[model samples]
Target: MSYNLLTSIDNNRLKQLKNFKTIILNGNNFTSFPSILYQFETLHINENPLCLAPPNDFINDKYISATSNLYVQINDKYEEKLFEIYQQIFIENLTSYDIENLSTRFKLSKTDMNDFREKYSHLKRENKIEILLNIWKQKRGSLANSDALYKFAQLIGDKNLVQKMQKTYLLARKIRI
Candidate 1:
């Protein structure tokens, strides 16, 4: 059997809807979703400019799934890139001093470092870069001494910084001071 549902008022569907386990609404104009949608076991509402605020019923109902077009796609890409960079950095065991030395060696602006910190909270948690550097000096460690410093220098594409870091490592080793 085939069925069709139509209504002008957004609430009308909710009021009339009954005995249906699944419903698919596509290519419709909806500023906000009705709470009745939460009653359905499965609902597919795609291609609608729903308000940014998620329905309270959906949030309260743990079983219901609501996917927003705006957040899901962009967040997914951001998360993927974040993880990729994180793995590369983690494998080399990048330390705080290494990050700072590399930043200075590469001439990375404060904004760039801030952006990296915002995107990768794990680095902050690992004690590589504290949220408040001066407040927690003793917890800080040097990445400048690490062999991974070379790999980080190469990633930044700054030959000058690479050379400077190499020179610093050599000088520190020779002086043993």
Candidate 2:
């Protein structure tokens, strides 16, 4: 619906809607792109707070409307680079306890933080770290750059971890250049 408060849609049930080729989800509170929307012939998802990047399969602009006004989409290569750097940092120098510390410093919304704790807290440390970074990047977009990682490390007051982050990032930059 165009003006309903639908935060999410049931893909299975929605798919069963006979003769409905398009779905208009404007003015909803969807923070993440509903993956199932791609199955529709047309989608109107503007006016929603869709921060997370759409799936790679949803690149066909013909079926979807403008969502750029609501969130900045980072280049896929850049997103991969950021994830690689953070993954290295987390794998080498951080533990679950350290991740917990970092999560507190993320300044994420209470609902987001709670969702992480409820749904993702029991995941393996590495996966948990990845999910945390993904959440941060989606919520903050360009603001969730290397500087934010450095600040999170600094907040933990682990000099060794901070040094490792700096060294790792510098090495990554050197390789890119």
Candidate 3:
């Protein structure tokens, strides 16, 4: 195939490779990828420095867009699906098992998984109890426990909190009736 990272190709070679189909460049020497790379059908650029940027030189006639266009589409789909997974776990009030399971399932490094968990923490048992108490205070005519919150309580296995929640719920139901 073609190589560009850590490899210096002279202008003469670059000119000869205009018809070349695939090349992987790392922008190791340059602040941005060379315009010569725009000619390829498939391109891969990895380990780019913070200063390295894509050369905004997509040619309509010669450049086929297999690299940039495909990368954007794939990145977008991956991010969307990832967001959905995070939301699902957060709403479920993620259990210790879910945390371990999701990280393993995604093959994420522990550090990466920790960062993700920090962003999407589930409500603590106390927080759920507080919310339930608030609903009782508001007397909103209905006292339906949110499924995620309840499920999370079940998974958390705090018998005291569960009993407290049960008592609170009966009290709220009595008030409503």
Best by TM-score: 2
Q: Candidate 1: where are CA atoms >4 Å away? A: 1-8, 64-177
Candidate numbers sorted by lDDT from highest down: 2, 1, 3
Query: How many clashes would you count in candidate 1?
Result: 1
TM-score of each: 0.32, 0.48, 0.29
What lDDT tens digits, residue by residue, belong to model 3 across residues 30-125?
334566766677666653332223556653444446545644554444334333333333434433334455345334456655654565468664
Q: Write the per-residue lDDT of candidate 2 for residues 1-177, one digit (tens) a residue.
A: 877866667767776875778888887756456566766678776655433456545655553454443234323344456556765785567653566666777767889888999998778887877888778878888777766777777777777777888887777555333
Q: What is the C-alpha RMSD of each candidate to the true structure, in Å?
A: 18.0, 13.9, 19.2
Question: Which order, best to worst by TM-score?
Answer: 2, 1, 3
- TM-score between candidate 2 and the true structure: 0.48
What RMSD value applies to candidate 1? 18.0
Question: Tens digit of lDDT per residue, candidate 1, span 87-116?
Answer: 344433434345555445444557766865
Clashes of each: 1, 0, 0
Off by over 4 Å in 3: 1-9, 26-29, 59-177
Clashing pairs in 3: none
